[model samples]
Target chain A: MATATIAGADVTVDEEGFMTEFSEWSEDIGSALAGQIGIDLSDAHWKVLNFVREDFQAQGETPTLRRVSKVGGVPTKELFQLFPKKPAKKMSYIAGVPKPHGCV
Target chain B: MKRLLILGAGTAGTMVANKLRPRLDERDWNITIVDQDETHYYQPGFLFLPFGGYSRADLEKPKRAFMPKGVNLIMGEIDLIEPEDNQVKLVDGTTLPYDYLVIATGTSPRPDETPGLDSDEWYKSVFDFYTIDGAEALAKKLETWEGGRLAINVIEMPIKCPVAPLEFIFLAEAYFAERGMSDQVELVYVTPLPGAFTKPVAARYLGEMLQERKIGLEADYMLEQVDTENSKLISYDEREVEYDLLVTIPVNMGADFVDRSGLGDELNHVPVDKHNFLSDAHDNIFAIGDAAALPTSKAGSVAHFAVDVFTENFLDYIEGLPMRGEFDGHANCFIESGRGKGMLIDFNYDTEPLPGKYPLPGVGPFSLLMETEANHWGKVMFKWMYWNILLPGRELPLPALMSMAGKIPEKVG
Candidate 1:
């Protein structure tokens, strides 16, 4: 775990560049994190990112793609379109949530 | 008298009951175990059945045979668990009240969860070996299946015996080779994980093994649906894998009654404290085996190890003493890599499998993370142990928590 600057704001991040502190995340910081990964933050993308952000707070862990699809009301196909390739990892990265675990 | 209600007399429930029956006074506690089926399946044998390694007869026995004499075995389907009322209702309209409840209703492979998976092609071109019927059907299919592209796909994860997919593909390669048709048949493993396994060291080792065998691995493919019309699998990313025959490990979920009872996660697995198997919502209720949503492989090995720790802690809990045992999510599995050789892996929640000997420091009759003939024999011998030692709640020679004694840790960059 190390401190890194994103969107001109300082935040703690893990070795994989995922933000460690969820409280350090904001709309501006999120957009910059997305920009670093070559993805622009759209409302469609925020829907997933926002859901992941809030769900992590409540669930005490990251929500799986199934949970995002089933409980968060986001279809998996569209999540793939919004984030591309690996939506679960990318969405959580932008949302400043821990990497989703447990065989998802 | 305090009634102890145990649901689904599978591995965890059976072990818990057997371990406690001899200890709990018959006068003070009324122990009752409920299940819809009377037969207890050797689920690990299901993987071997597809390879013609075991027959259906070798995998099943009367559930009551393994249970203790004093415990009441009730055969019925669970309709609902009213946690507030501390009672469970059966499908036959009988209500059973309890002072304590244990949900050992394990997870199952639900092929119908995925669309086009349960349609006309099911058991014809598409198959699953998770269930007894599926395993038997697949065995017959393999007996007559002409050589073609055989694709094994894992639709999702947290499936019981997570390593079975790798073992299936490996055994298939050997099976086809034995029949002199290895040249005609192509094997591919389609999985959601990015590599051959979840852990880094084991994944690298297993991934190399797959490459050496020339097995094609389509990684990180999140399955969306099966297109039976085209005889292909469609992913959420719009990638399609066409195959002559498909063996699928579908989305696994816990008993539906868990969801109906409102005491489960999205997959219907009960939310339990990882350390003690106690439910997060209710203190008196506990979930063991695949029913508990622990961040580990839902394997019978886990259930056994957990029952060991749970038994010790439970004995303390009933006496109003502080429960001492803490489970480390220990899991040990044997991977059949074809031939007469197999590999064994043992680790806990915090530690990944390392290359070493198990049980014994260096003289391990079993080697970890490497293939050996002894490991294969150890796996074969486990059947007798499961019936004689494990189910009877006899103490295993192995420790409940993982030990780092024999392991030589490697530094990977």
Candidate 2:
């Protein structure tokens, strides 16, 4: 049981530092979290974050990376450049969506 | 009565027991299989656990279920093998004498060997998918993890399932996109080899796949330590790669008893003739599967094919006749790419994996070295074949030796 103060709001997280409640996420909260990880969210980051959040809201499941590359209009190579490390988990964190089940 | 005692009742031992039970006369010969544990695991299932596709219940079964009824099953840890005395001593001070011995004990991931790999960060920020517990723990970690540099490093070479790391990263790419986080994570592959794989052709082909997926490959990396405080992997050459989450395949080695018995090579793998698996030091002892030091990839397919050849040669050797069978070190593996597609690779000791049809030369339902949905299904179906047909020692239509019938070798450049 861990909690992080983000954008003046206390958000719950698991031991691995993943947000426990999607409802507690906000743009300001994501920005605050991103700042801790040494990232300043640009338009590209928001584009993926918003798309993931909307998809999770509608389908109750996150879209696959292939889906993001093909349907979300982001090229595969560009996705790596944007995320720079682990894009799926980071994007879900900022978008206020749950982590994809199979991504490591 | 002659007693044939086999050590480590895993894949190779179990198949040998089942294959020889009826072949040997019950009156003159006694068969016994020894293992430290009663549980048998479908090891390939470990790959699917992190993906929410498998559970402990799906992969575990009783060891006795696969062992033939006539073969005696002994549950005890092996302490040492006294090849000079033709006996094996158990941890509990029991000695089993054997006229012929087969060692099927397999290799295991040894995170402890790497400095700082098993530190406080293990199972927290750093994890391995080779073990069931490690895979299960990672499943939970991935549940809530916000992405960072996900570095998949192979600390050394000669690890089990050489293609598995590639499959994992490929599957990860698909898994991340499915969650619409393709832009939030970076994928990096660090290896000790010079390329994406061991063989030249396969390495070049797989290296391109890595490029297509945008996964950075840091090849020829010899891990020196894991900097837990800073979250980085340091190589012997003083190079460093930082990561938020590190999934690694640690150094793999054979059973410790092999070392204790003074029957092992540098990695504790028993020194055996690559063609027959007969121990170079002892004519009556054979080491098969991951336990043997063969110049081929350590995989289930290799064990199956080796077992096929060893069973025939063993019969001849025990009867004081010339052994007729020779193993060519054939191995086949399915590479799982994301998006419901996969690729297959088949080769032997002399040949590198080449692109062509497998089994059928001109008209294969499955393509080799190329991605297809059919290849994915083949991988899915292999689990069934492993348990029922392969373990039970039932005959498979595939040849034990590598076939060049449909293989296409690259023309001289």
Give chain A TM for each model in order.
0.95, 0.86
Predicted complex 2: CAPRI docking category? incorrect
lDDT, candidate 1, B1-413, per-residue tens = 99999999999999999999998999999999999998999988998998899999999999999889899999999999999999999999999999999999999999889999989989999999999999999999999998899999999988999999999998899899999998999999999999999888899999999998889999999999999888999999999999999999999999999999999999999999899999999989999999999998899899999998988888899888887899998999999899988999998888998999987999898999999999999999999999999998998898889899999898855
Candidate 1: deviation at residue A59, Å? 1.9
Question: What shift in Å separates residue B50 of candidate 1 from its native position after superposition?
Answer: 1.8
Residue by residue across B333-358, what tens digits does model 2's lDDT show?
99998899999999988898999988
True contacts kept of 2: 0.00
Give lDDT tens digits, candidate 2, residues A36-94. Answer: 77778899878877887777776566665545765577754466567655566667666
Docking class of 1: medium
How does residue B248 of candidate 1 score in lDDT?
A: 97
**Least well predicted 10-residue stretch by lDDT in candidate 1 chain B:** B404-413
lDDT of 1 by residue, A2-50 (tens): 8898888999998999998889999999999899889988888888888
True contacts kept of 1: 0.71
